[model samples]
Target: MSSIVKTNKFTQALSDCIRSNPKFKAGQSYADLSMWTRLCVGLSDTEIFSMLPIALRNVWADEEIHPLLQERGAIGTGRFNVQSLAATLVCFRRTETQNSEVRVLQSQLAHLSHEFNSLSFSVFDILKRLDRLEAENVTLKQALNIGGLSDDPAGLPKTETQQISIRSDQDAVTKYVL
Candidate 1:
């Protein structure tokens, strides 16, 4: 099989793969490396990638993407290559999978993740405020010499008798900040 003369990092890797892997010793060949010559054929890789759904676009630079594709694109510079997209297209086309549904689901998941993080931070802030208010409540109760289960009916776990002991008519006069 004829080897590609226009060698680059991507082509070299493909040639190495053809030579080393046992399954390709007869079926595939260095001739396949010519595919890399069209890396930017009709349109720039960015334009082609932008035309694709996010599912295929992910193959170029995702941390979870295969090493070959990750190497083909520059994540820092947002550079992409037709070789990577073509490889990804071949893999997906074999399964006859639709990428639009995948892209929609991924978008929903990302949105949910962002919302969950925002809600988690809000909940954390609320808990901190509650703790501060509880502390303040302690000081006020101690200074006023007040005691009651009615103060915080949901206080520490208690036996029925303990529950009865802390209640008082003073619940009517008590002021709670929470």
Candidate 2:
């Protein structure tokens, strides 16, 4: 069969399989069914049909399904099995759930990054203010003669005056103000 024919057959088979089970019908929405179909994109109809028995035995067996399949005479017809179809549906649901969780985490991380940047700017501003305050404190001490040379020039220690003058001039010029 052509690829298009095969795809159509596979689609029909999967739909029929899903309709056969009440659990799949009630639990899955149209969107969920579409997602399950998308997950089967790479598989050929023959391959998918071939997996039915194994899928039914391993993944989708239930008392209700068995009676329904028997009533329709679909059991042992070499068609799509519930287990096989369920495996694909389960995988698609899990992928969607994880993607949603990842999106939530990414948004949270972006918010945290913004908060950190704002806090960083605030800290920088505080440091600048502190530097300005320290510079003012030094200037005030000198003006009040609280920690500088004695008022009388004759009373100054000769070596200390030279060092103090040079240091104070540099401090006055380089002091940072906010």
Candidate 3:
């Protein structure tokens, strides 16, 4: 009837739910307590205290310890009804925590992807510059002809006729002069 009674019932029920949960481990005791506290925040102060420990008991070393702790946490007054409320609270807290972690991971992944893209583009730019340099080097080698005798003519490679088409006006002028 009173807020304290309801809160106690909630807390006991919560502890029982925790003990039953398969996801949690005894090693994560601090997490267990914190989760219990968060769950209880939604209920009345008195109900929260009653239910908080019950939820905490749910985190055990194994199945063997779980039943013992579950019994201890749920033995008090208003045990039956409040257990359900405590279980609901735990589920809510777990989901909320999981969702928050997912969002954080997604943001980190996005940042890494952006960095990878930038690095890839930079590498492509460098490769493009190198290719241009190679073409230019070939052109320079043809022009210089280092160590070639002036008269020992290895003539430059001939351009195709299509590559250097004569102007029609120039051809006409040459013909008239001839």
Candidate 4:
């Protein structure tokens, strides 16, 4: 197959992948890194368009992409050389399998990220419910004039529950901000 077809096909495949997964938010670091990694792998270390298939060579060499890929080590600036591309390919291609493993790990991280996002939302929801319940309880206590504050706030389990709650709450808050 032509490298153009191959590169286009690869780009499309990556695009489809990100599109299918809601977790792979566009413009995010993960998306950028994934794209760069694919480009690094697909472009065979940034040789000229001629070195690739005739159709696909100049397709991605737009002003915007040229510098970006160069920065990512996908392409060299100005000219294209088979030797450079070969060296780069040799150096990086060896790592392709390892990179594949990293990508798998990254995908797993993405899955965990989705899970953590869901769980964090759930935790926040529970905290909101707890707040509402606590408010209602306080109202009732005030209505009944249940006097005397708890003498031992420190008696609350300071170990497991509190730690988990604090960590979860912090995580939720952090995710929300992000």
lDDT of 2 by residue, 1-178 (tens): 6655755565455555556554343123556456455645666445554543444443235554555545544444333345545565556655766989999999999999999999999999999999999999878767757656656675566687788997888888788531
lDDT per residue, candidate 1, 74-127, as tens digits? 232232444454455444443333566787889999999999999999999999
The list of candidate 4 runs beyond 4 A from truth reads: 1-92, 146-178
Model 4 lDDT per residue over 36-109, tens place: 35545545444423443332244344454444444544433333443444344445455667888999999999
Model 3, span 14-33: residue lDDT tens: 55555576543322255654
For every candidate, C-alpha RMSD to the true structure in Å: 20.0, 13.1, 11.4, 25.2
The clash tally of candidate 3 reads: 16
Best by TM-score: 3
**Candidate number with the higher lDDT (3 or 4):** 3
Candidates in order have lDDT scores of: 0.46, 0.59, 0.58, 0.55
Measured by C-alpha RMSD in angstroms, how accurate is candidate 4? 25.2
Candidate 3 regions off by >4 Å? 1-81, 146-178
Write out the backbone clash pairs for model 4: none
lDDT of candidate 3 at residue 42, scale 0 to 100? 56
Report residue 113 deviation for candidate 2 (angstroms): 0.8
Residue 127, candidate 3: Cα error in Å is: 0.9
Q: What would the TM-score be for candidate 2 when compared with the true structure?
A: 0.41
How do all models score by TM-score?
0.30, 0.41, 0.42, 0.32
